[model samples]
Target: MIYFYNLLLLILCYLSEINSARILGIIPTPSISHQIVYRPIWKELSQRGHKVTVLTTDPINDSSLKNLTEIDLSFSYDLYNNKHNFSDKIDKLAGKPLEMVNAIITMNADICDEQLKHPKVKRLINDPNEHFDVILVEILQPCMFAFAHRFKAASIGVVSMDAQSAAYDSVVNPTHPILNPDFMLPLAGKLSFFERVFSVVISNVMRVYEFLFIIPINDKVIRENFGDDYPSCKDFIQYLDMLFVNVHPILSGIRPNVPAVVNIGAGLHIQSPKSLPEDLKSFLDNAPSDVIYFSLGSNVKSKDIIPSTRQIITETFAELPYTILWKFEADSLPNQPKNVKIMKWLPQQDVLRHPKIKLFITQAGHQSIEEAIFSHVPMVVMPFFADQEGNAKRIVLKDIAVKVDHKELTKESFKSSILEVMENKKYRENVKKLAELLQDEPMTGLEKAVWWTEHVIRHKGAKHYRSAAIEMPFYEYFLLDVIGFLLLVLFIVIYVSVKMSKLVFKVIFKLCGGEKPKFKRH
Candidate 1:
């Protein structure tokens, strides 16, 4: 009887089906890390029984599986095949990050407007007899904002990186806190007043951008494509209105939340943990000391790294009490050290999870950093560009990591930083404590994300979760004008008090002994 009951319970759990709906996931990741970041959400949505239609670019077409629709943008194909160093061209484009984003938006806008015959976009804007119910959209591409408007599907913006990943960083506020999720991931002890203020400002700006830029563009796209025949853009946008962000509140440093936005940290996306090769496992288990894993992300070529830095690592690992597994792209390291092992590709999360893996010297990319946090492994961060700098800063400031620059990538500095993380033990303890908080949350990142996603779907949109700024202008939403008016009133009162005080002092002096000479009452 007990066995029968247990079997029935298992059957019932397995019978759990998704809310009767299909989710059309539109991700615009032009880079590999971005693709990896979106993977968990993709997997979760699919596992939840939602058939996903994905539209994005991949340099090398990844192996496809059941229930996934992949539309490659070919954003990095030639670059990947040729192994080109063309990134300098993109980075050197002179503009603020927001301006750069605006440029990208306009560029895509121009393509849509100027060349309506383009095959890629024609398919996107094509009229389909069958309609999609919910559209999970990523913000990086900006091209897919038009999809929600055209299809009249519920749309949610999957913010892949920190709040700075969008236009809200320098525009009106700062989302620096969204980087590591702890109060600005303090420089020394805690976030300074200015840092806190900056973080608030970033949050405000992100809210503002979704309002001013994303919404208006989405509306315009729908208006243009459907010729006002489309349904109200507002209904569809705010309807499937969930902000599926890959952020943990603990690492974010701020627990404050906006309605409807699910903070799923890096979640399961970063951890592409695969079973280790038997040979590699044997090698590690046979090793005398703990190991250090080093890799710059996928887009960053280890072979392209200046030979000087490579030599520093090879020699430095030889001196340490540990082995080093460096993920190098090339066939082999020219001057090899016996203590160092080079593999073209290593299972990053799997290596980190190993009991003998002591420390990670990383590029401080958001995904890797979170993986390290999840595994309770400390980091020696060497941020290369963009948000890496911010991520590295947070790790160091949080006392869980020590930051060293690429320019400072010397044997001595690298060895010292690794040794400090290995020997001190506090860094590991601090990271472990944070990992506890991140893990002990009510739900796992993936679970929270899927539940909220289904909630948005079941409710037919997340309009309730939206920030009111979606319908209101920045001035009205933040009530900046009202605040200014109140400040002005306060200034007036202060001025009046000072004047009254002066008058009272003069009257008192005149009444006592000192005469009010050269003074007249008005």
Candidate 2:
């Protein structure tokens, strides 16, 4: 028996080596919310005998994962933290579309710039011996996509949010300016005339700006690092092997994707519920009634909230009948209520999975919404910036949540929104249905992600999955060229017929009365 077991272990080792790949993943978005989406991916790939080298802001420094190599790009967060404070800008950037877009574009470029400057990253790029079967890069940072060019490997664009409008264009995935709108915009549902105009105008304007100004800037950065002979970032984007979008139809609605694009649902980082910490367990386990879990996610700190709003929240919570678990960063609230429990951090998934959790008051981050749905809890979304507003609108449209206007937030409005979702049976019912649909897929999201990643590596590239629309010009793809040709032919036929009719009229008149007309003219 011992001899047979040894032989089986040897056969398994041989198979692992035969199928193993060298994967390079550079997901340098400094947000923990973003990093969590891909963390599971790295772990899964390594466990399957792939040699994975990842450059990330949040490193899963687990020594147990012997096949994973994590390059710490945590300092990129400093480049952001030193330059800007997200807490201050979160509310201010809301509803300011141009400002919000410009900020995101600048930050993407800046992060890419900082990523190239890191000593380990520089060595990795400079090393002539380094090779990879595939490179997974952040779709947000086009400059970093140059790694694919340098390594001469298949490139897969990975985004932690729903695929943005510009991203769809890169993959030739179907998108409508008003109907599908950019995720960054706060617009959704049936648009009013002005809203439709705004969506169409802004989406086109940004598309042009991104192609002309942003891509050129990113291209220059790429050429600087990867050499001038490297292809333009625009060209690189057009040839992406595959794009992994963190979207599922259950939450984000039904959107079209090309064969090259894969929807690896948003709950990638969610793990099985663990035993809660003693303090939280005691607080939750003994709650007198139902509980409300409130959090604004990682980027927006609860302590940074304005004093007036804080007071309003405190006063309102004091009157509520249920227990409130507020993820407040500070140690204590000025006037804490007996029913309110403040914790600096939370195991959000575990907390939401608690039986007593009735409703979640969230900032409407995608992952947070996914967690709430997965746990079958409803939400009162207070969207602040970026995709949060759109996510809030989507969840509300799906009948799984309610939205509170952060701009007009008051004690009454805040309290009412929370109560509305908690008291309504429809919200809970809708969320439960959504959770079931999301979980009813043939393969789990993580499994699908791993399968697709390996598929690209196994085939060297997913060129067969590429869309013909990617190779076509905009006029041809929209059939405007064909339409123009038909219109031109119709015009020519009408012009010729008019001329023929006039000439025949003159001929008939002359033939009938030629001599009489000539005498009159003389």
Candidate 3:
């Protein structure tokens, strides 16, 4: 009986192994904000019995997740920090669409080079035995997508924010350039004619740059790492089985998405409120109902603000009745107000969940905005760069927040924006209403992401979900060939009709015995 029981146990273990898959996630971006949004995905997949190996810059080193393996690529941060100073350029490249695109494309190429050459990545590549059943790659880094093809796995694109126009087009989704501008552009709302023109120009320029510059760099990287026989980087788009974009109808306006695209942007990184630190809890507990939570998110540091703007912020905070919790990176802030509490880092979601909190002053990152909405807190959004400007526009349009332009920031403007969000009852109501809609989804973002990921794993690939539009030629997809044929037919009919009219006139004139008096050679 004991021998029979042991044999049954072994058989059960074998069945489980056959059912589970090996997933490789390449979230190689250096930003903490980007990594945090995807953390839940691998963790949940591991919990569900799949073996997950992630090449990541930020690894949640949890011993409990026995099935998860993390290959740390934290060195990418050194390259990122040495190359780009986001703080110094808040007033410069933040508003310039072309310059920003150039900067990001250059940085992605640089990071991709170092990432592919890293020792651990090379080991994974050279090991003939290594295989992944699925590859979840960050779509922003096109070079990373090569891993999907390298492993011969079903590829899925993932983004921490809304998908770029180029990525949308790659999957054959409509861009609606004027109605929904690309994430790189700062212009939002009903655009002026020039803004509309600028959007179209900038959007196309990015796609052209990706084709001419970015893809070549990616192709070169693939050859150096994978092999010379590796397929072209542009060809990888067709193998994309699904895209898990961090967007929702409430965040971005209602837009069409292909069947394979799933939105997991509804606070995927948000967690249940944890116990706040002692000092922090004391601060919030004793504060008034108008307490303010201020953070610029992880990528942008509060201590890095220019001196003049810092002074304006300090003075404005001093004048406000509400206590402020600021995520100041530095250990000490000179002349910090008594009512203001400064911490290098704070539990942002927990702080927002506090009952005493009234308003959030933020740089309007997508993740931060999602948290504010989840907590039903209105905002005073001072957008600095990237998608912040667009997010600020979205919330302001929804009437849940007031936008304070970073360039036009003043003590009075800052104070009034804060007061407006706190003093007005409608902002809170609008936020609550929007939050309800966001929360009304049938499954949470994590569930949707994990379910679809497993779905792709179960089926081996999702080629069926791929849009037929992706395979269509440009002329055929747009019906330009059909249009050209119709135009040609119309031209021939008009030409023949003109010739026939002239012939009829000649016959009539000849029958009437009219002489050829037409030639008056002047």
Highest TM-score scorer: 3
> Residues 4-96, candidate 1, lDDT per residue (tens digit)?
999999877666543446777765545667777666767767766777777655422435546666666564444333433333322333223
Question: What count of clashes does model 2 give?
Answer: 0
lDDT measured at residue 319 in model 2 versus the true structure, 0 to 100: 86
lDDT comparing candidate 2 with the true structure: 0.88
Per residue, candidate 3 scores C-alpha lDDT tens digits across 327-432 of 9999998789988989898888899999888899999999899999999999999888888888899889999999997677899988888888898999999999
Q: Please give the distance, in angstroms, between residue 247's alpha carbon in candidate 2 and its true position after superposition.
A: 0.7
105-210 per-residue lDDT for model 2 (tens digits): 7877877887898889999999999999999998988898889988899999999988788888888998888778888888777788998898899899989889
Cα lDDT, all candidates: 0.66, 0.88, 0.87
TM-score of each: 0.74, 0.94, 0.95
> Which parts of model 3 have CA positions greater than 4 angstroms off?
1-7, 510-522
Name the regions of candidate 1 deviating beyond 4 angstroms.
1-19, 58-66, 79-121, 165-240, 270-274, 478-480, 483-522
Off by more than 4 A, model 2: 1-12, 507-522
Give the Cα-based TM-score of candidate 2 against the true structure: 0.94
Preferred candidate (lDDT higher): 1 or 2: 2
**Candidate 3 displacement at residue 462 in angstroms:** 0.7
